[model samples]
Target: PQLGGPIWADPIHDIEFVQKVLSAVSTNPSRFGTSKRIEGMLSMMTEELPDVPLYYALDHLCSTVHCNTPAMLQFRSALLHAGYRVSMSHASRNGLKTDAPPGVIWDLLRCWEKANPVKRERLSETSPAFRILSTEPTLQACFDVREDANPQSRKRHLVRFQENPQANWGPKARAKDSGGISSELEDKRKLCQNKRKNQVTDASQLKNFPCKRFRKGTCTHGDKCCYSHESASDEADKME
Candidate 1:
């Protein structure tokens, strides 16, 4: 099916960007880092660009399949509308060499996927295509959405989430900062500490002497003790 609507712009800009990228890589320029100029060019493609990076996998590293597959682009674009990070992989072509290079000939496609969520949402809403390229919610977060917006259960059922939901992927800083203690409990602890620091008690002035050692069951002096084991109850009563 012809998935895209009529093209409005001429192919001139496309040709210009492609030639510029090709020229940049060809000159062996000093600005290129790690002899990986192609990666730099790939990174720059997202600069004010309408494209989403889709990395389809070859089970065999050195396969004959062309890198720029048009069908993959359309399929991925459709999936992008549904809020997904889509990549196609050949299952049967696993006969390649084991000592392959790490990472991409370009930056990892998923990293590029998260680059522009606004453009992605716009692409998603454009054609209303149902051809699913992928279903995985590559980005969503309880942390990303407002707490009232969607519950954690509903988060998984939907693709789109709050803007920049990556913060949900990490440990919650607010919970850690508060040490998971509630404000009431923390206040009670502070109150107890303040009582210990600010209130001085004299055993001689007390009507009922409470023995600290009795609480731990370490008191050897029973009836002869000036502090009474029963005084704990009296102290509790006084406080109440």
Candidate 2:
């Protein structure tokens, strides 16, 4: 006995329920199951004949459209009005031809624009598929063909970036989770200071260094590394 809300709603389970009713002959039969709720409900046993009731069943209604365009919602509404159970699924642009029939595509766009005037303009304007369709006639009839003919095709957009991508922290800006540049600089500064503070000093180390070049900030080897080494050498030489 499937004692549950789902059994009352789903149409496909009606036959299964009937089969279970016919098979269970004993008052207290062991029913193996996964759901704890189902197991607990099935544990109910009665010596007297129990009455079970059948309610409504569940089923999904759906429909398909050609092109899988942005005007899908509008098109779905039109089909629904014309007594068709329809729903839309996203498709890929690689399969769709660049030039689709203007009439059908335009009709879909018109209906979409009417229903959602604010969003219709430039909705698919910059899209690759739309751009190709707008300019080329070779693939004009592609959009007119029903999705069943070629179900995998869709419209998509491609964008290009010329500069380092700007991270637009909008009006409500929060610090990035990544430690900031200041924190990194501070860490580096601390590391440098610690390295200098814990530096080992010996007479052999002092003798093997160039002290003069670093004092004027012009060490021929490199500016940054040379400056620090030369500064240390100069201090050591002064001490000597």
Predicted candidate 1 versus true structure: per-residue lDDT over 186-208, tens digit per residue:
55455567565645377554426
User: What pairs collide in candidate 1?
Assistant: 81-124
- Candidate 2 lDDT over residue span 1-240, tens digit each: 135554432222244453465245222335533233232222221110122223111011001111323433334344344333332221211112212233433444434333334422443766543443343222112123244332111121111112234454223333346844332334445546756764656655554455466567656666334224545656778789
Clashes in each model (backbone N, CA, C under 3 Å)? 1, 9
RMSD of each: 23.3, 22.9
**Local lDDT at 69 for model 2:** 38
Q: List the global CA lDDT of all models.
A: 0.36, 0.34
Worst window of 10 by summed lDDT in candidate 1: 91-100
